[model samples]
Target: MTRCDWAENANELMTRYHDYEWGVPTTDERETFELMTLEMMQAGLSWQTVLNKRANFKVAFADFDVTKVARFDDNDVVRLLNDAGIIRNRLKIKDTIHNARQLGKWHAAGKTMNAYLWAFVDGQPIVNRYLSMVEVPAQTPLSQQISKALKKAGFKFVGPTIVQSWLEALGILDDHLATCTVNHLSK
Candidate 1:
């Protein structure tokens, strides 16, 4: 089956992620938070690296439970920094904790990450018809707007490029190549 060119030569884990998870729409708050965290962790690193250490991240971040992670203290930060299984970036680690607290505040206000994000696209994925990976952009105007909103909302490490990737990863933006078999929009 034809896959996106980037995923074609990837390792088994990445291949599976491409086929099964990437660009799949999800409204689950936990899953949304987890994807956002993973995207943030991927800054200055490869997605493959993040995927390689995903299990460790899940364990380290309390399965991406917003409340649990928001409660992570200085001791937890130190533990994450010294953990060999995940990325040891202090900024990303602390940012994850801070972002969790922001999410917690949103939760208290009866807002959900899923709803906040999907609202950008009117609750539907923006299906793109690019014929090749080259046609896919690194960041778009929409991403920039979203990044600005997120930053204003107190999220860190969420620049436009990262926000764009996170949007794509969450299926808010479906960027699968039109020629690829996994392009559900094409089908």
Candidate 2:
């Protein structure tokens, strides 16, 4: 029943995420966008805090549907700002809308969101063998490259650290500890 140590202290919300979602590879564009949005919202805050408010986020942001969110306007911004169920940070909330627009632009430009996201790692998930959370990195050079590229592509709120988490969330980077039963690359 062993898991990544971080998940040990995770509440039911996090435990479920770790067990079912974390580290699982995903290629769906909408799902990828959702993960990136959630990870972006997680910046400067805890995953649990975001997880606790995930439902609110989903509801507020059109269930993480990038297309619908991309259409959000000033009125949507005002509404989100006044909501207590989710983080009311104006910049982050506004950025979600901007990020969705960027996602649409990418799609319009013939870019496969999934392929573009996976290209950083050459269409493969990175398998790590950390023994503990301390050995895990907050960011890597590849993550930095991806962040820079994504920012260049017009995405907001995506820094190296945030991109790193996004990569993990997309399962493009498998950081599960060697001791974790869910470790995908354990020997």
Candidate 3:
């Protein structure tokens, strides 16, 4: 099947994520949290690696349950540190919990993760018409704005590039290349 250039050579795991999951708009709170968390884990790493370890992450992080992950404490940190199935980075592990707690608070305030995230682009995905991967940006002014907002809310690993990737993955910003077959179909 014709695909985005970045996904063209992807392995089975990455291929499935690209074809079935990436850039698909979701309104589910859990789903949104999971994608955003995975994007955080992807900092300084490859998407392939995150894809490969996703199942393990789900298992280790209590299926990405915001309440459970938010409740994670010192013991959880030690446990995650010893878990070889997921990324062993201390900062990432800690930040996952931190973000989860923040999410929990947001939920308590009646804010759904998907809804809050979609507000960034006015609840519509921005479909880019770039013809090539090289034309896609690593960061944008919009991304900067989002990153700033996320950091203000006490999230970590939410740099401009990381937030941009999260936005793309969540379908808040569709980055599929115009030359890519999926670009037209990605929505």
Candidate 4:
């Protein structure tokens, strides 16, 4: 089973993530929010770092529960900052809280993060057939558009690059390499 080049040399966790989760479309609200929050935490950092700390993040951010995270206070912020297992960036932590609040508003309005995001692609994943990771772009016009929309909708720390990664992680944008086994699986 040939994996994507990036995953081939990855640690066990990343290898598992690539094989089972990456590029797999999901509509679960908690999972969607979790991936988005992880992407936000990944700004200026490698995906490996995020994956490495995912377990810690899940614990620190209340299992990525939208309502729970949205209710997080400054006390929670202080707690997260002192956690050595996860990234300790204060702005990212606060933005995750802010984004969770935005999701809370969406929930109150009878909307879902899944619906709002999948709507951008007309309810289908955008499949890309790149042969190598090098062909995968860091950001694209679609990401820029989504970033603008998310920001306008009250989400923070969601710039184009982060949005692009989030989209990929959510399987809204399938970027599996053509030669990778998961490429066929995602399709």
Candidate 5:
């Protein structure tokens, strides 16, 4: 079977995420929150690592429920550190809760996460036809703009690299390989 150019490994998890979730536009506030949190957990780590621990991350993160995660306390942080299924980094774990709180703040400001996020692309995906894996970019001006806005909103772990990946995953940007079917399909 074929896949997106970025998929160097066609393992089960990668394949599933690529086929079903990657590059698919998601407007759900909860999902955007989850992706943001996961991207933070992925810092100094591999996407595959996060994917392998995804189930555990979901459980530890309370199924990516924004309200519940935003309310997590110090005790909750300790509980997460002891959990074997997810990454144990204290800062990254704490950032998850921090991001959730920011999400709530955005909502209170009358801007849903989905709306605020998708607005950077003007409610359309930035489709790129990369001929090879190396041809795809790590960051774009749009991602930079969003990253700046996210930081201003008091969100942590939203650097340019993470923001760019998040946008691609959320389908705000499509970096599918030009030869890949989805590249032409999305256009």
Candidate 6:
């Protein structure tokens, strides 16, 4: 079976993530929010770490339910910090909960995160051709704009780098390699 071309260092977990989830269009608000939180938590950490504990994160964060996560309190923070299932970082855990609350506000304002986020690209994915992994950029002007907007919208942990990663993961930015088996949109 053919698979998406990935870096040689990618292990089974990363390979699976790249094949199944990377550059896939997603419109679900909950899924988008979940990935946003996960990516934020992945700031200094590797994507593999986030993927490995994704199930645990879902359980701990109430399946990424915006309402529930937005309502997390001090006690919840403490619980998450002590939970081995997810990352034990206090700051990121707090930011995750905080960002959920802000996202809820945005939703209540009749502004869905999907709509708000997709607006950066004028409601379309930005396909990028790359010869290899090194050719892929870490941040782009589009991501910078999105990051600025997200910060203005009161989101935390959403710098340009994280926003770029989100764009790629959600198919807003397709960074598939030219020779990738799953290079359908690379052309």
Best by lDDT: 1
Candidate lDDT values, in order: 0.92, 0.86, 0.86, 0.90, 0.83, 0.84
Question: How far out, in Å, is residue 159 in model 4?
Answer: 0.5
lDDT (Cα) of model 2? 0.86
Give the alpha carbon lDDT tens digit for every residue of 42-91 in model 3.
98889888989999999999999999999999999999999999999999
Which segments of model 5 are wrong by more than 4 Å? 182-187
Q: Write the per-residue lDDT of candidate 1 for residues 61-146, one digit (tens) a residue.
A: 99999999999999999999999999999999999999999999999999999999999999989989798898899999999999
lDDT score for candidate 3 against the true structure: 0.86
Give TM per candidate. Answer: 0.96, 0.94, 0.95, 0.96, 0.93, 0.92
By lDDT, is 4 or 6 better? 4
TM for candidate 3 is: 0.95
lDDT, candidate 4, 24-85, per-residue tens: 88899999999998988888888899999999999998899999999999999999999999
**Ranking according to lDDT, highest score first:** 1, 4, 2, 3, 6, 5
| Pairs that clash in candidate 3 | none
Model 6 over residues 124-147: C-alpha lDDT tens digits?
877777887888889999889889
Following a full C-alpha superposition, what root-mean-square deviation does model 4 have from the true structure?
Answer: 1.6
Q: Quick one: ranking by TM-score, best first?
A: 1, 4, 3, 2, 5, 6
